[model samples]
Target chain A: MIGGRLGIIVSGSLTKGVEVRLDSAISVEDIAVGRYVTIEGEKRRFFGMITDVTLDAIDQRVMATPPDVSDPFIAEVLAGTTTFGRLHVLPVLTIGGDALSLLEGPQPVKTVPVHFSVVREASEQDVEQVFGQVEEKQFYIGTPLDMETKVRLNPAELVKRSNGIFGKSGTGKTFLARLILIGILQEGAAVNLVFDMHNEYGWKGSSEDRREVKGLKQLFPSKVAVFALDEESARRRKVSTDFVVEIGYDEIEPEDIAMLRETLGLTDAAVQATYRLARRFGERKWLESFLAIEGREELNELASSLGEHEATMAALRRRLDSLRRLRFLVPHARDNAIQRILDYLDRGINVVLEFGRYTDYTAYILVANLLTRRIHAQYRERMERALGEDIAKPRPLVITIEEAHKFLNPDISGQTIFGTIAREMRKYNVTLLVIDQRPSGIDEEVMSQLGTKITCLLDNERDIESVLTGVSGKSELKAVLAKLDTKQQALIFGHAVPTPVVVKTREYGSPQSYKELGFREALELKKKAEEEAKDLWG
Target chain B: MPAKIGEVIEASSGEFTAQCYELHQPPSFGSLVKTREGEVEIYGVVSGAATTSIEPGRRPIARGREEAEEEDIYRSSPQLSKLLRTDFNALIVGHKEGQKLHHYLPPRPAKIHSFVYLCDAEEVEKFSQSFDFLSILVGAGGQADELIAASLRHAAAAHQDPRDFLIKAGKELAVLLGGETNRLNNILRRIKV
Candidate 1:
């Protein structure tokens, strides 16, 4: 290899083993072992390691020998002294070159700090180049997938399931979740049921200009349906409304009833009585059952006796009151929302249940629990009917739970509806996309069960570690994540990506700026604007 | 003989002699009394008769000329508190004064409020030897002056600190004010304490 220029020869045992003094222009502090150093006229760079530093007498006799003869001569000359270890000025060079080059100065090298093989640059013919790189997919619930970086997902893998999204306030978790749902829907592979707690998604425009619509007439006019639950029609009329529905107590199986009873914090005796009451009213239907019990003092007396002997009367009364509030069992409801969901699933259309506006954590949990159990039961029944056994068959439904950590928590008294769905969903083609800012808080088993993961800018180290543990072959991806810009930039791993990619998320319609205004500030701004407009008008 | 109110006493026990500032009349038999400073509580027996050759206790009263001089100083001295309210303003004001102020001002005291008690004659004598009681009053008066100098230094450092506002201010001040203000750039190069 050609060398740049010759400086002072500090020490040399042989031509190749010379210590040449250099100037202070170069900051060699950052140089490392595996770096490639290029000479001024050389076509290729020589790779070298930083060996050692020496300061002492300048010995000119050592520089006389040639490159080929230098190794043995230097070893012999520097033997049995401290200079033997310290004499060699720099570390050993793996690449061999001419001896004459050693009389010249060392050139700088380009550092490769991270492990990544350079792939062929983007060509005109590549689909990615033509369409432009797929922007990062902003999911409502799953980890963020950066479109800029390339990741490969295997579609033929054994893990086929839905996902859940979860995070605390202002973590942009809901936005990420919606993006995941939109991606699945775009793929046209599986139907989805999104429990949108705040009614934030399923709108045509960005989050800022989102308009509320009852049905999917604007966006997915062909395949999607949006249903809003109405309270009045659900209670007065037994008839299902257009978009509202009631879950009949009779339809809930004994086991599911037990689970619900546990979730509602009902006592054992109350649970048993509710089950019996449900079975007795099964033949007459919900409205007729109420009518049948209206004037009957005998049934009341029986209830009282049972209440005194085995159950808390107050607890039973409260459970009955709760049952009355259920939208499905209420008569004259505008539409059975659950039935519509079932119908959509049957028709293989994705449904977005936007609950984005709801802040009540308990209400969100209850809705999620109800929907998941219903879906599970429906899937099991269908699978049993088709397979002649209770073996789970792949149903083309994926449920995406946004803010999933709240519902899937093992610490909660209720059954782990989300966790159960995550574990068992794959069997019935019911997949879960669990998205959370703090992935560490999510149940470890449920997180492990998620076949695919998309990760974004994770500020928390524990979340990053948990994500890394869940996905494989992501060492390079982890390094890339350290330098990611805060946009919707993210690294996607697991079955969703064949390889990890750092991607900037695509703008969905008009970008919805969910910029929160502090309560007082928003009010003040509104009042100020109104006053200003009025003044101008006057 | 019991000590009278306002009399000073030297309670001697070998080398331990405390000059007590008597606030109340000593009782018969002259019991020793102890009271906490800055508190209303009184403890112990009353001390015996005491006297001092030093000037009798006199309430502190600001002289008319001194008060007028203080008012003048307050008006002339730049409000460092207000100046430091905004980092940008602090930089501007600090750049204006710079090293000249630092040269005239005493070194910044380690503690802003330091108190030394003059409880007894021997303690008073020891304190008198170490520090001038008159100079202490003068020293206390110069606190605001010292603060002004420190504020200037802080502002000068801030302007040279490479922040966007400081850089802009430095550039503007150079164009408008001119002269050796350009030397403020050297402030940035200096090693921080």
Candidate 2:
């Protein structure tokens, strides 16, 4: 049977949600917060989630001097009449119960259900109707709590704006990110440019139990390109690399250093001095020229000539000297790494740039910021040209970055390219898929700008608050988000899903899962084709 | 036909007093009994019963001092049966109008001298189908809890499943006495099978 009738709407309001009085026959133990339910009103059916449960009695004296309920007879009699359970439901969408709703589908509820409306646990059909069925652009992410019905997320709507995936460490953020990436790929929504800091996405990544799972390249070889910053590390891991990305010292600019001020512990004067050096040596030669200065006397001569404070100049030199230790940075590059990435993205091939062993904060911030700044500028130019000439716009791009707080923290969000993309990059056909553990550390404005947010269990009060910032029914959703399972569970809301839902993230990393995701080797496909041909001939 | 238990000796809209056919043989406390007035049948539960001297203020002397058994005194003085009479009081819980049974006070009292009969198992089963009368019984003033416990026990005897019936009746009492937990608990203790 579909969900049996649980209760009736006893008393409620539109702003504070509705209260349901449970029937005497239903036990309160069977009810859980965050479970979905439907209310059959006079005119339409409303869908909502259970947010709270309470035990109540008709008279306060019954609680003061309690009845002798030790005997089963007294207990049974008093179970519902003298004492009962009450539920608090937040109605979100009105399911099809009227002619208008029947044609247009579910709509956001603007009114409360009439008094005494019946409420039942949401059935599979009701859930499927509200979340929609899997079709061309809809990808199945996971099932709602305790249900077998799949919840579909439309990747097409998802890539139109920036989004975030957050959780505490080891809360399966990586696994969910992988699933979303696969969703984007399957839907062909946009081309992904992932800054793979730990080399997790390009090749095989380990699960929590240290089991290796196939990466994106293994799943779609022809559609994905893996670029490694450390050639030796990529070879060590036995991963086939498509490109080696190295940043030339001449490629570094003053603004890139300014964004890294906090990570490098550089003083304000030191940051300002980089601009002076850039102006003196020209935009492309500042870092190479500054690093070539040999001794304190020569540095002092330049600082005096430029009228820069001696201490600030020395500190800037010392900080700039640390950049030499990063093996991927050289005086000159053999090829343009940004242009190569652009070429791959233009051809609709997703690129995962592996940092390999340089997972240090300084390196990740510098390289990611430097590359994104130039790339965003190029995209801006191209988008304008497309608009002016009435030509086809560039393919939509989604940049995936981890440890996003480092780049999007309040101080640097005003200057970093990631912030620009997050704020208003949709006009230029670019967006960000930010993955972070401390969402509280990200700028509030940027967090609000995210199109959709999928978050795992976050026990910290601040992180939970940050994730639910601009969402309607914030307090109610906070309870659901806080109660999510530590692994393989998340609460997704916003643009893609019709309403907020707590999902047991779809399974990944097994042979059966791989098969379901359409993973096949070239030889196997060819063999199958040959057998089909043989069957046709015979 | 059911045995005639009594006749109404005194009547009121809410309650009626009936004289049993035999001395010292009034109906049991809380058992249901009924009487007819022309076309209407008025139902009531036996609230209290007593046997006393036929005339008020007439105290009889002891006559069984030398008798070996209590029956010998009554046998020796045959007129004793005429001197003593038993009567019972029933609160008008409901009445039968046409074919329907209501759980409310009838429009008029059972007529004086109306013949009363103790309801059988089938009638008791049919009458107890709805618990709407429990509210009237609960509000019947002084020792109402005891009267309710006894009535439900007697009513449960007519059902195939007595414990299930008692539980259902107990739940009804729980709702009616929702504000009085102690009274409900006391009655539930008596009615539990």
Candidate 3:
């Protein structure tokens, strides 16, 4: 640390955290929320994050002016606004060594930093000590807003549990989500499947001004497979396609349609009619045969022959016919589309299912729920089998879903497959990187399951309340949350990070940022995977 | 150069009292005055001044208006200046030992009857370079802000660069006053130009 005194410790009875005032060189207002400051302790150097900065008048004269002044301006000028600042910093990590190095990782504050110690801005070296050495396991998401030091998260922790990225619209939520996926890919810690509703993740996506950003497929071509519901849309955007996933009528289960009940605006009678049709024609072939009946002529023929209510069948057909326009559904041309996804995951290749221009909530929800449900069930079975066998468990999988509230809202959470994965995916090594504008819409149970959350600015009261979780020091954290810049800044805290830090997300799409984020390391792994593919073929 | 005003009659670490030797009336309140103590010189601002007989606990007898004036009785007595003594109380600002000046009270106060000099232009000009003395003056007992402002005007005029001296004093007061910008601004408004 610098030898100069930043401030003196005002309290000697400090037990939990130390209060150190800044020296005259700086003021309290100058220190921003979430800025990292260091205090010199008796035995070790303690690193603290500024949670609050308050201004106070030190003398009564500073607050009041003598009333006898005839000139108002003079009276105004004479009234003292001389204020002292009080910085509420929380000590997070403590280091013990003559020479502080990242290699000597800091431990959680076992002993609070010494009182009366000078507090200074946490230098790049001090910040790196808390985050520790940057290795394959550590993924640098961004640098802290106040310091130039990089803030990295443990990817191993990310894959072991579910996490979330939340922010209001235009707060760079998607950009942050893309960065996290890149981090997950660089580490090869998990096979991520991004359900791109707006077709933004797999192919080139431009920002508001059409600033073209390279998609995940473009970055790692062989490692990521771009699966689009409509091949034409993907081709129009020049997104190289690996597979065309189509959900055939025969493959649509009762649960798949049940997931869409609220979205399709279907009545309870309509859902029961579909079930009745399934029971009569057998569950496997019922959806295919039902789609075969196109008009009222066929509907009337099936109703009379099958001995069912004519109005109920007609309502069911109307709802089913309305959904036929969706490209994912086809009448028995091939087998299950989910098998293809399992094939990609089994091969350790990530899959990004682009919805093409299908950015609608209902379609995105239906497709994501159908595929994730089948795949997550398969994973649950595989995990159970792995427990009994000697073979290693399958590689961890993280599914990135956008508009997460549509599936996880309390209204649908009880039946939505996405909700199931959110609450119980950890045991199956299948976690979610759910992204949304309204985190408050998600069920409280699923919110609690989120192991780590990287949230940008959220103004909605409920959204802020939901994102804050039940962490201690919530009021202080809320203050920090309220001050987050609307662009490129995030507060990361929870299981994946040792402490909460506000980071200015590194520039995405910049070649230099890509290199700094370890894109080369991932490319090397891609080459190795190609080699292994060749050896297997030979 | 201003004339020598009086001699120090009593002294302490923070303040001293002086008896007028030649002047008809004591230096006006908040006047910049000085006295010598050994090799070093001590500085102070007059907090108060009074006229009384050399004899203790005495009050002058006032009769009706004399001559054509309504309040000229005291002036009519020509020997009053000789019979009575005038003294001023000065709050110690600092003392200069050698070439370096300290902005605090001196270790030793002025001696009895040490000749007190009305500060010359050079003396005031050199001391005005540091506004530290203003803190002591403002912190003194009565009407401190006004006294400090008055002292600044006198000192600023003594300095070669009066405008710059006043500006520097204003800056120092801005910090010392904390957020009391009105007081500092008023002082600056009064002292500027």
Candidate 4:
């Protein structure tokens, strides 16, 4: 048999059953926790350190590795072989290294260089297995920061500040954000509003797809109202006029006017002048009363004197006119939806205003900002009432903003309402879960404020660097984030987790079947339906 | 009785029938035959009545030895002769491999056939008639000569009757020419020709 200095000698013949000790020849410095070595011609790898090494008292020449071995064969083998020879015979392997050299002498030995190998192969079982922790109170940003290791977070620490989820398309930003929301809602927290920009999150479940349906309803019930501003819905509702009226001059604050001026590239003086005009018109409700102002000449004359920025004033007036004409801004009816959402939130019910098909980025930004600001205001009022004396008992409100880069970018100037909420929401227990494709694309300030960051497979280098800059424990987390594979596989860092972990996202309520129908199936179904219709008609 | 010069006769069998249209005398003359909806030319050194009767509407056939030797000449000519008239300079120049012919000739059309009508004599002189004759050249003088040689060769071959060979050859030639003709007809129809 091939024999060498025993790098490690165990009490038992079988590798796994007994305690092992390294040969004195192998220097303590050279032996690593995960290093491998050859022992008695059998290849063996060791996890952790060699705990004990000593000579056998009964047999003067033999060294006893550790623990008492009663087996006669093992005892005889141990008596005959030197500790170095026994330990060295088996090969030591490293994760990315060549097998360790057989121990030649009793002197301390060095570990072999690692040869790269496919040591960890993910199997179908890995994909099918659901691995996560159910925690009390705060969201369990499941698993360790390393995608390979399982680690859980301390839930109590997570809810203190709002979270942010940001990544590029197909990076599992939406799925992870939904998981966090589900975690929080499942813990019996008051219902919070989800300003779903993509309309991907809040889906109603059907009887056949009961799991997904129940999961969605548990998160967002009928109490959660949906307002679709799509062309078809707008036309059908016939409330476009009221929508405009509801977006009254009051909706545009002085700061908002300043922002509008900046966005429109107008002067400060012009902005102040327009603000004054708007304030006066708003106080008198001239926008609402203008329709009753019988004389068109009088209305035109009144609109002209607004300011030197007559163009902006005219646009706003036209917007008002269009709203009235189309009956789109039906404030009373739309307000009912808004109020219902707020009422659900007040009753501790979660509300999701899913924006499924709104393509106009400008409109989405405007509406989401308005809703966030309104929700922040309500939350602040509730916090003040509940913890007037004890600021510590702050009612935590997790506000998950999907596609956050559109509204939360810090570069955009003027009082961005979303930015204001982001900055001040922390004091009122308003946490922001900012979800996007690339974390780098989100406002740097907003990213820095996110205490808990659950990062998934980030293909872009810049996005990975952005997440690294935001999180504190980069060593393990960076390695984990580098290797993320699927939608729910994420390296969760920040206050929510005790240590960074790689966790498979837990299923909340109903499983979402965003799996689109294939083209051929859809076509076949359409043809079949047409045939059936023809048959029925005949 | 021995066959007279230029006299057409039927070559018939239980399964086949052919007509010979005589072209020359000396028992070495070639003749064209129409049988079973196909036409072929054949040549032979001997002629006599066959055992079977000729089918109605089928014409008589003839074949002679000189026609057979001429066929060997047609088969040996290069492909270029089939694309252009024998008089064309390209036939002479292209016959030499690696010799450029572009300067003297227009680009060759995509599809070439033997029976295509040629009004240009320059094309006929430069290209060998065998190579230059397209499937479209059925009624052309060059095709008539080639047919005469082909029929004579068929007559000289023992296993297949000359008349039968001519009929089959005609049908095959028709099929080969049919594709190009249909394509040309389509082009003409598109142009409202």
Candidate 5:
């Protein structure tokens, strides 16, 4: 009903996609890229996702030169000439039977939006069926551009497997993550643990524009616990840190040091010396014992005694000495950070570990691996314990990891614990919301395991190629992906939506958007509408 | 409704080809013309129109071009124009039988030498209500785009509500040439009436 009769389909082949010229009366504001539309065909209504929109002059007559360039007559003719807009719409599906029947599931449509059909802005009814009914386990992620309608996502599908959000820098990757996290929080579908490397998501964060974004802690204060690695750093930023996350030196193993070899720029001989140190003094006290030998002669004497490479041991000892100011790497802890995290998940409280000022790649990767590796073991055990037991099923957990490609790259994927979690998917009640720019760098095993990929505008072909590795209908989807705007727009497909859709992600941090994000209003209306629909269709 | 413009010189089931009785002047392109054969009234729009010399085997030859004014040359060779003639081709769009005006092509062709008359405003007004003739105007082929523009202009002038008539015709053009907006715009811009 909104923007009634936006345009009429003129001509376009099924393979090339449909070209709909806008009505002469319709303004440019009525349509845009990532807008959802509907074409009323003879037999059925075909729904489309607008991948591209372009303005066109009615003819090449605009190229004609006027006799006098200064004359108003010439300008009048040029101005009065008709120019129209063409919306290149990719038909996603068709609906023929009653609305209730479509709720069963989406039936993939291969047919095009027919010739000369009336194309209009898709109504709320079309959107509801297209994204699937919003009665339960549904959350509105964003609104499609140029619409009053909200585009919802099924959270149950998202948390049941791994998913990713990718974009180049400043393309709102973190902002999108925050919006979806709000959806997850509102739906209460799963517990979300975000490893906040930039300390931006728990409290108020600002975009590059310096506009303030309302964070998870502000939205769900009681349910979210913000644990900062450095409490002093959090205090300076005016954020309340619930617990100080510190790892015991005892938790550091030879493999933990080995994992940091590439990051620390250590050689093969240096890595061998790290393992030799772990063998000489057990895994629990190896770093402490190795650091205790300050002199090169003392390190050489220890290396000689152990029959190891003296110079290599000296290089490894020198690298370990640089871990002086790390707040998380302490000599002892009252309790393990992994146990605290498990307790939070068991109680259904989401934990966001904020690395306040420890934003270095080396510091972030080292602590994240240590925490996630131990936490994975505990969650796996918990999932196994409740497999056949009378105990209640644990809540599903989503681990939000930023810079995911660092740990998930093919070179170290076999050694990293995330590779196992990515391969296992939802088995341990834990899945990843992998946030990164370089999806091309993430392991293929993990990339294929990703259920839903919400991608922002990415210009790199390799990155786009990696993001679309095993996807069906990639050529069409590629054009859609390539056309996404640099901001707010996203191509969301996989387990949740019925088909690949380029949507203008809803407003983030606006009062109106916040009201919709609350779910108290939208969800209630959805329930009432569903009940009414059932009354009629039943 | 108007005076007899011509007689049907050539006739077919789908077309009515005629020449102006005055020889030098043919009905303007897109002007509605009709012919009567018994109870059937065949209607068409001027889709193809031209003026040519009637001499079968020879082209008109100009003489003394430099010495004579344009008018004096014509005066010197009065017989040159006697062999010249004006004619037009029509796409048999619709017909009228009995008292009812039907918006479809007539089944039978108008007989040869049947008198063709220019349609009056009342007939143009009635046909302008619906745009069934637009598809045939575009499909008529030769100078079809120009025909569409000329036809809209002629129809608009003959109607009481000229703007309303043009708008309705524009909407029809939106459907037929929706993909061909370039041509649609060209035709629509010429609807000055």
Candidate 6:
């Protein structure tokens, strides 16, 4: 059994963790890093992870002139007596044996286990006691290493603040994000507004193996709406989208253009010129009027009258002209896209805005920023009014964005609506689920503001460091994070979990997995059970 | 029952010397032997044995050159048997009082002229059940590795699984001589089944 006694605590401290001398029968090679272990102290049971394994000898001379261990008798005798395996264990949480602690559950360990305490491999029940079983608010994300016990992530606490899902390219960030979104939807924690960059979260998404998997809309048609920016592209893919969305020129604000300065390659003067143009023309008419001044003589005259450089105005015009090529941008939109999204969110239905063919940074940044700013303003107004009038506050809304560094990077994070939501939007019932491949590019403040972070294998040193910044036992977690398997494995920690845990992510792309994820088959199974019950009763 | 092998001629708390009753005969070296002082039974391992002239100043000359065989000389000189006595030295490893066996020195030494007996297989098995006496044997001075190896080999023969017994004893020696890898290797090489 996995609960067999592993070893005893030989030496350690509260901060540096403890060292365990393994039993002779347990070979050092059998002990793996990141495996869960529990120490049975006199007063408490401490749970920890194996961070390092080392071969130790009782005598230094034995190493220099090694005994002839080719003989089984000699090897067996020397194994535990003269040589043994040592494990470096970081005790993270303590499940106190006292009655008060039993009621309180696992708490962060403030003291180390006593010397020579018995340490053993953590059993399934012990893990369940710590992470808990799948409950209403707790979502089963995955299983820990060499264990079947589910590691449940608390979606209720997760939605209370912004979160980030990070990994290198092709590390299944989208798949993980989709699972978390499904968790939020399933538990009714909050309504999600996903800015689907590559149409990955709406109707269908292709896995790494190229198999088409059902997206959120196909699974929960009534509770999900897929809005497409390019309807022709959506039609080509045969995705039955809920609505086609467009952005009018008048809807663009000076701040929106200012946030897009990097993506549009606008200089400082050009970025500032947006504010000047908004002042010259009305805030609602600035973009349309700026585009209307086509001739060079009229542009120069307008620039002179506005006390702006002609060259700067020309550069700003040239950069702004690129937005004209985007098919979704028009002088006037058929229906207000922001109102449609807010209405769907207010009705407790999630909305996924599919970029369709416009998956570039320019288009993604422009559309996501413009739509979110207005929606956030609406939420802020409603929240302020709710506080003043004491009416029921708006339902919490989580806005999901990909390539978050583009908006939350240090240079533009102060002005982007996504950055504002990440920093202090929890009071307004709005949080951001930022997905990015390069977490290092994101601002430090935003990264630290994240409530919980679930990341896959990232070998970059800076990325790993940034993800583990401000975390206690950072070095131990770094070792665990660096050794993660590249596929379907993740390390989750922060506000939602009591301790950092490495998990083999749950299955996501099969008929069986779909049923487990609560697809239509689950409803059919429920109905069948109900019918059987009715027959038995009647 | 144990075989009566000798009589304690020299006695001390840590060790005792016994002279065999028969000529040129002594229990095998490193064999388990026990002697008594009143009610306490003191256990010892036969560290060494020798057959020499009983007198301290005299030496014996070889008369076997002209004899047809070595036995003829001893037969011709009947006094030679009395002249040369086989004496063995046993290091006190443990003692037994009442029903409990202790792996430590007794409060008193073996009495002079006390009978010494070679322990039987059952007694050897009972004594070898705990390896605590091993520390005493390891620190018993000269040729300790060889003495430990011989005693363990003799004790193994008393168990059902000789190899398991030797391995268990070998582990004890390994811990006792943790810093002396060469000595441990020598003992292991000798004791391994």
Best by lDDT: 2
The model with the greater TM-score, 4 or 5, is 5
Candidate 1 local lDDT, B56-159, one digit each (tens)? 46333333464456556435543421222110000000000222211121222112111212123332222222211122212223232232223223333433
DockQ of each two-chain model: 0.00, 0.78, 0.14, 0.00, 0.10, 0.81
Task: Compose the digit string of candidate 4's lDDT tens values, residues B74-178.
Answer: 455434223322111011111111322121212221121111121122321233222222232333233333443433342324322434433333333323334
> Is candidate 2 or 6 superior in lDDT?
2
Estimate TM-scores for all models. 0.43, 0.95, 0.77, 0.44, 0.77, 0.94
lDDT tens per residue, model 6, A243-350: 899899989888888887888889989988899999989888999999988799999998999899999999999999999989999989999999999999999999
Question: In model 5, where do residues sit more than 4 Å from their true spots?
Answer: A1-31, A40-43, A52-88, A98-105, A110-121, A132-138, A510-538, B1-35, B44-94, B99-118, B128-153, B160-193
Candidate 3: segments with Cα more than 4 A from true spot: A1-31, A39-46, A50-119, A133-138, A294-310, A333-336, A514-538, B1-6, B10-15, B20-45, B48-87, B92-111, B114-143, B150-193
CA error at residue A324 for candidate 5, angstroms = 2.2
Runs off by more than 4 Å, candidate 2 = A135-138, A520-538, B60-64
> Model 1, residue A328: what's the lDDT?
39
Residue A144 error for model 6, in Å? 1.3
For model 6, the local distance difference test gives 0.90
lDDT of 2 by residue, A1-538 (tens): 2498989999988777899999877889898888899999999999999988899998899889988878888888788788999999999999999987799989999999999999999999999899987663357889999898898888889999999999999999988998899889877999999999998888788888899998988877778999999999999999999999988998999999998898889999899999999999999999999999999999999999989999989999998888888999999998999999999999999999999899999999999999989888899999999999999899999999999999999988988999999999599999999999999999999999999999999999999999999888888888888888899999999888889999998888998777666465434666888999999998
Worst 10 residues of 2 chain A by lDDT: A515-524
Candidate 3 residue-wise lDDT, A1-538, digit = tens = 2323456566522233456665544555466888887778766777777787665554566457433337543333322234356677777777655344335567666556555777777878777767765764457887886566777777777878888899899898888888888788877889999999888778677654568887787676667899888888888888788888888677677777877787787777777777878888888899878877778888888888767678878877777777778876777647557888999989989999999877776678778988888899899899999998967888899999998888889988888877888888588889999998999999999988899999999888889899887865566678888889998889888888878889998888777765666556567887899999999998
Docking class of 5: incorrect
Q: What is the TM-score of chain A in candidate 4?
A: 0.57
* Model 3 TM-score, 2 decimals: 0.77
Give the alpha carbon lDDT tens digit for every residue of A1-538 in model 4.
0122333334432232223444433333443221122222223222111222233232222232331236432222223222222221212121211233223212122332132211121222221122233433334444322233334343335556756665556666666666566556545443556766654455442231233333233343433334444435435433121121134333534444344332344466645654565566664343355434445465456556654344544454444343343233442333544455566566666666544345445445655665666667776777787776654443466666766766665565125656666666467777766777767766777666678787777767777887778443343344446666655566665665433445666533333322110122334566889999999998
> Could you tell me the lDDT of residue A313 within candidate 4?
48
